[model samples]
Target: MSHDNSAENPKNIDRANNAVSWDNSIRLFLQQAGSSSPTPGGGSVAAIVAALGASMTSMVGNLSQGDKFAAIHERIAEIIGRMNRLTGEYEQLLHADISSFNAYLEALKLPKNTEEEKTLRRAALHEAALHAIEVPLRLMESCRDGLAEAASIAEECNKNVISDLGIGVILFEAAAQSALLTVEINLASFKDEERKRSFEQKVSALTQEIGELKIRALEVTRKRIAGDMA
Candidate 1:
């Protein structure tokens, strides 16, 4: 049996480490968007926003994990964990966004000299665009849920971390709003009436949900904060 030495190569090791570091840097990059970089763009930014919301929820739960908050800690922790998983899913969605864009780019390069090829390219572009649109739509939904979860925690979590939960709700709201833009932009390119109508309906529904969640979160946070101040 021939032993493969490629895995042991110093350059390969460095490359592997670099990939890991890059993955980790995504979170940092979104945290500091003012800095220049091509990737971790709007989609990644949305993911980071969702992650921040999840992180804040987690912080509140962790702070309340002791006997004082025993009744709610487990439930809050479960919600936080779900949010964290959603955040990770959003990150994966960002990667999918890149792949979806690349597919569209490839489709654009397809030979237009033949009608069959043209049809194929059009189909490819349509599918790719749909994927692009769906990625953000899903993120919007996830962020909307995060906003709701954050609001729930804000209303009932330990007083000390209520502000953090508010921040989480705000981040999720921003993320949802941002993701909705991507969904709308992609939807504009889709030519199918039925599909367009379906997407539009979904967008409308999500928009309403987001608006309601935002209002509810703000109201809860404001009331909690006001009560604390009083």
Candidate 2:
């Protein structure tokens, strides 16, 4: 729940996660974010938003269980469990994003006055940049799994809550895309051509999978809503 953000200084990860409730924490985070301080920035927000989608998927799964959809009883349980796990992963990622960036920021502050200092700073920066790249990379993978689970649960959950599935699709799509953008930025900065290629491949794969799952969920959601009306 709490972590020191940077190796050198306490970063925003601790400051952001200290609130009493998720909703209150979001409110407090947003207020702090609106300031000049740049700790709980876009990466954290993306994970938080994706967490909302994952939590909603769990809600739908829990509510859709019982006699009404007994055929999917076991499946619902599994989906809810997956969503809970994804939710927890995203929670930790929210801090990881901030911590990674904080590490990069700390590297940037390294002394650059001497030739030796400059070389050391350069090496440290490349290391930190890789860390920065890695956080969003894992974030994309988490979003990838979260979106896939959302698609699977869409067809099984209650029609009354069908609309939340659509929202989940949108959030998952947004989360994946946002995380991809972050990775792309770091990929550009990172000096390892092979690692950049690997990251690029993941971005491509995650984008495709996230897209297909979102479309599949939307189609299923529409049919279910129409069937309910009929």
Candidate that scores best on lDDT: 2
Top model number, TM-score: 2
- Cα deviation of 33, candidate 1, in Å: 5.5
Candidate 1 weakest lDDT stretch, 10 residues: 12-21
Query: Model 2: per-residue lDDT, tens digit, 1-230?
Result: 11223444444434433322345565687886676555566777778878888878888888887798998899888988898888888878877776666566667678999999999988887887887778877888888788888788787678889888778878878987888888876677668899888878878887888889889988888888889532
lDDT string, candidate 1, 8-104, tens digits: 3443233222211225675576454444333445666677677778888778777877787777877877886887687688777767655665565
TM-score versus the correct structure, for each prediction:
0.83, 0.84
What is each predicted model's overall lDDT from 0 to 1?
0.71, 0.76
Clashes counted in candidate 1 amount to 0
